[model samples]
Target: MSALLVRHEANRLGRDIAVGDIHGHFTRLRAALDRARFDPAVDRLFSVGDLVDRGPESEQVLDWLALPWFHAVRGNHEDIAIRYAKGNPVDQTSYIANGGAWFVTQPLARRPVYAEAFARLPLAREIETPAGPVGIVHADSPVRDWSRLVWSLRLWRAARDRAMWSRDRLQGENADGVAGLRALVVGHTPVEDPVVLGNVHHIDTGGWMQDGRFTLLDLATLQAIPPMG
Candidate 1:
């Protein structure tokens, strides 16, 4: 087992922004960033993962994996994508049923590269911000203990099951914050509005839904943009 935690060096620009489940909505994400006057040189985007699937630009978002300013956690969608790419018939069925039709339509030769990218994504990230250390996990952090969570992340199976898929942590959020971090940001579950349960925040506004839009949070000010039309 290897450590799955990635430590993002503290950003002093007070311009770190977090965006909820992208789900392949790159254009919308860019619009949100433009509206927010995002400066990639200083500001960093901590994506709550799900960078692909469920939208027209799913494949396009994969092209951004190499950009330095973007950071992401392993979301359940990514987990599904990876499993399906590895020749898991059951996972293939699940992925295709869950908005992965476009993925299945792609050439099989291109699938391995995508799988390699997903495999490299960190399951969780802890960043030192102007406020304090902010933790980012795709869905929920099943373990309340930071040390234990790190331990669990080292094992690929545990990280995939708990960090990427579990929603149990939502029930534990409160003003006290989870794992003693200043804040915990998550996105597997969608919410109409960004809501904070204790110190845990769910920012996924369902960008893939017909009536929904992506939510981008300016962590420095704790303010998020209203969903677009």
Candidate 2:
């Protein structure tokens, strides 16, 4: 992955817009946004994570996600990078089998940029909306009681730990989804179609697999914008 220069501050908005796992499909992402009439100049876009790896254009995806108009949480692939960055013993076999080698093979000059970008991404985002609060993460969050979990430190820490370890138990309908929050948006388990599980939305539609289409979910309306391709 290449280094993405953060030219501006993070986007903080009361409005709603959320995107699913990009996985390096820049052309498709642009086309989807165009179809949806997304205006980065005004509206905000949130990513579910896994912005890189297992794709032909990881560098471009990194650069695109780094744009000021978008925000993303850390995914399992990112956790692998963090471990690699820290010289921690990673599961080399699984990491490479899962496409970590591509990222490791990138030019050294670009590694720092990716590392910095990864370091800056928040584990979870709290969006204050008229309806209520929306929580965004790469996978399932630890908020057992969605209503009480809004902006809670305990929930954040649990979600952060699950993200970092790539724990499978944290992927699906672990604890019956969010209770009180308006919605919990996440991307990790690639689905043939984007799924709305209770208050949770699974937006990773396997762009790396069969027709190579990525789905972007509109947070406010819960609409799935299929890949433009």
lDDT of 2 at 195: 74
What TM-score does model 2 achieve against the real structure? 0.79
**True-structure RMSD, every candidate:** 2.6, 5.1
lDDT of 1: 0.79
TM-score of 1: 0.90
Write the residue-wise lDDT of candidate 2 on 20-115 in tens digits: 777766677777778767777777778877877776777775667658777777777776776677667987788778877777786767776776
Full-model lDDT for every candidate = 0.79, 0.67
Task: State the number of backbone clashes in model 2.
Answer: 1
Candidate 1: Cα lDDT at 152: 66
RMSD of 2: 5.1
Worst window of 10 by summed lDDT in candidate 2? 1-10
